[model samples]
Target: MHMIENGNVAAALGVRRCRVNVIAAYPITPQTPLTERLSEYVEAGEMKAEYIPVESEHSALAVCIAASSAGSRVFTATSANGLLYMHEQVQWASGARLPIVMCVVNRAVGAPWNVWNDQQDSISQRDTGWIQIYCSDHQQIIDTVIKAYWIAEKVSIPIMVCYDGYILSHTYMPFDLPDQDKVDAFLPPFKPDYALNPDEPASLNTVTLPDVRVDVRGELAHGYMEIRYLLQEELRKTLAVAAEAEKRFGDIFGREGDPYLESYRTSDADYIAVGLGSLTYQLRVSVDALRKEGIKVGILGVRFYRPFPDEAVASALKGKKAVIVFEKALSYGYEGALASDLKSALYEHLAGTGALPAVQNYILGIGGREIHTDHLTQALRAAIQGSISKEPVWIGLKL
Candidate 1:
């Protein structure tokens, strides 16, 4: 089925098709519409699930945590301060290893109180133990929601599906909605390995002593270090699981892109522009325009930020003269988060090759500031000509 819809509606429809058992949400800008749609689905008998309306974002995620521990497939959405408010619970859910899926409508965190598209809210929480998947458009939004549940349940790690607020969240686009039966076939019901059962009771997230101890069966029980180590290991496993999910989803739905890093015309290009989310779409247009003007430019879109796709990114950007990173969020005194990660990935993997590309970071669209192809084109041109300074460039800045 094909229909014209915004990203919020697309996400709701995807969750409904997944047969989610519980939805606990607190309404926040941009993200509110998604929860609203889900509520309508539940009320109209279109979806057989409980729509939990919580008073605050903290409670919303807390409800999801409780539901998920009880063997239910749970979901929720939030943006900006709402996400910040749920920071503690976010860590709790991942620490408990609940496969709870969340939609973070990327919005600018407040100081001057702006409510528009910015990736700061989600990027700030990158250290949390969740699989972060950034979507470029409405189609990816729906598809990623279904894929997230599959990946999360497979690895027992929570997943965060992020997209630009207002830019992708409210913008309308025509996307093909996969048939419910096909989605059902692609993604089976989530069966957790362990749950809160009265008959088969087990202690969860119990306090651990600093050192490991022997259990009743003479097996060593995990200490704090061991538990954290296992969490890191599980996060590493998500790289492979994400790839498999993308492959299987494509086989069933016929829509496919690189689940890690998507490269366009990067094979032989001298210059490349790299970024994540809806900004990648604008960068692609700029790449085309630059190519027509005889500039050897391409694009590398970072789809999966958590796993970082280090090896793949290094390979794609090996021979390029310069790789310019466009980002909407900055890491305060340091470079943009995505740019810093890319630099580290290249340095760690390509140090032996001695042919690392010159990398640059340009912060744009922060606090809902507008971005256009011309702005990106100018930045790419400067990067290619070696005119951009070593420090990060701020696009659309009045000063």
Candidate 2:
């Protein structure tokens, strides 16, 4: 079925197709419409799910946390400060190894209180043990929402299907609304590895000692450190599981692939531009312009941000002359997080093989600042001609 809809509604329709059992959310700018549509679906008896409209974003995710622990397919959405409000549970959900899928409509975290688009909100939460998948457009938003469920369930980790607020959330675009039958065929119902069942009363996520301990049943249980170690190991394995999920999704829906990195003309390019979310797709304009001028440049979208696609990034970027990275979020004093991580991956992957590419970092569009394609073209052009900066460049700054 072909339907033209905003990214929010696209996500709502995808969630409906997914047969999500529990939908809990609180309204925030750019993200409010996504949950509002879900609430309508639940109230109108169109979708058979519990839409719990909580008072605050914290409680919204807490509802998901509780519902997911009880073996329900749960979902929630938040942006900027709201996501920060649920920071504790953000860590808790993944630490508990619950397959809860969330849509993080990316927005700038407020200091002076602006309610516009940026990737900083989700970017800040990257260390919180959740698998973050950034989307480029409405199609990826809907498709990734469906695939997120499959991947999360396989790895038993929470996933943030992140996209820039307003940029993708409110923009109207045509995406194939996947058939309900195919979605049913692709995603199995949530059968948790363990849940809070009264019939089989068991202690879950209780206080742990420093080291390994024996439980009441004389079973060797993981301690605090051991549990953390297991989460780390499972997150690392998520890359492979996510790849398999993408393959199954492509086979069934035919709109999803390359779970880690989405490359645009990078095959025979010397300089590659890397970024996340819709900006990566927009950067292709610059790539095309540069190509016409006989400058070999390309765009690499880092899809799976957390678990950091070390090998995929290293493989895509190693042989390039310079990897120009543009980001919407900055890591305070340091460079853009994506740029820093890419450089680190290159260091490890190109240790003995070849010289590392000059990873030039540029921070732009923070707090809803306007990003122009020509700006990208000029930045890459400078890098290609060996005119670069060791420090991160802040684009469109007013001194």
Candidate 3:
């Protein structure tokens, strides 16, 4: 079915179609409408799930953690300060290996109190052990939520589906809605490897000594270091799981997206613009206009942030003359997180090739500031023509 909907509604519908068992959330801007729609679905009997209204984001994820521990499929949404408030629980959920999926409406964290589109909030939590997938539009938002559950369940890790607040979250678009039967066929019912069971009660997340210990059954049990290592190993599995999920989703829906990075016109281009989220869509427009004007420009959209697609990124950007990173979030004194990661990936890949592209980072749209195509075009032109310095360029800043 084809319908006109915004990112929030698209996400809610995706969760509903997945037949989520529990949804626990606290209301926050941009993200609120998503959960609000889920609540309405539960109320109207359209979705058979428990909608738990919590007082804070911490409590909201706590409810999801508890439900997921009991072998229930769960979901929630948060933004900005609300996400920060759940920081501790976010780590807990991933540490516990709960397959909980969440929608994060990307917003600027407040020191000055702004409620607009910014990627800093989510980018700040990049090391929280969750698989972060950024969406460029309503279609990707809907599709990613469904794939997130599949990937999370497969790897027994939490997934964060992020989209720019107000930009993708509130903006309306036309997208194809996948049939429930087809989705059911593509994704199997989640069967967790471990869960809280009364009949088979066992200690979970118990404190372990420094060394490995023997269990009652004379089996070796993992120590703290071992457990941490296992978590890292499982996270690595997400790379393959994400790729498989995208392939299957594409085979079923016919709208395939690259699991790690989406390359556009980069095959024969000399300069490439790199970024994530809805801003990438705008950057694509800039790329096209520049290409028409005889500038060999392209775009590389970073889709998966965690378990970064190092090899794919290196391959796509290997021969490019320059790669400009346009980001909404920055790492303060250094470049943006994505830019830093890209540089590292490029360096590692080009170690043997002995060739490298001039990488530049342009921090833009911070605190919900508007970034127009003209700004991107000029920056791309400057980078391509070697007019801009290697230092981070702060776009739209008042001199």
Q: How much lDDT does each candidate structure score?
A: 0.91, 0.91, 0.91
- What is the alpha-carbon lDDT for the whole of candidate 2? 0.91
Lowest summed lDDT window (length 10), candidate 1: 382-391
* Colliding residue pairs in candidate 1: none
Highest TM-score: give the candidate number: 2
- TM-scores for all candidates: the values are 0.98, 0.98, 0.98
Q: Which run of 10 residues does model 2 get worst, by summed lDDT?
A: 351-360
Q: What is the C-alpha RMSD of each candidate to the true structure, in Å?
A: 1.1, 0.9, 1.1
Question: For model 1, what is the alpha-carbon lDDT of residue 3?
Answer: 98
lDDT of 1 by residue, 1-399 (tens): 899999999999989999999999999998999999999999999999999989999999999999999999999999999999999999999998999999999999988798988999999999998889999989999999999999999988899999999989999999989999999999899899888999988878888899998976799999988988898998987898888998999899998878998788887799889999988888888899888998889999999999678888888888778999999998998889999899898998888787798998999999998897799889999889997567899999998
Model 2 / residue 238 / CA error / Å: 0.7
Q: Per-residue error at 159 for model 1, in Å?
A: 0.5
Candidate 3 lDDT, 1-399, residue by residue in tens? 999999999999999889999999999997989999999999999999999989899999999999999999999999999999999999999989999999999999989899988899999999989999999989898899999999999888999999999999998999989999989988788888877899999887888999999998999998888878888888887888888998999898888878998788987899989999888889888899998998888899999999788888999988788999999998878889999999999999996685688898899998888898899888888888886565799999988
Q: Give lDDT tens digits, candidate 2, residues 63-173.
A: 999999999999999899999999998999988889989999999998979899999999999899999999998999999999999989988999999999999999999
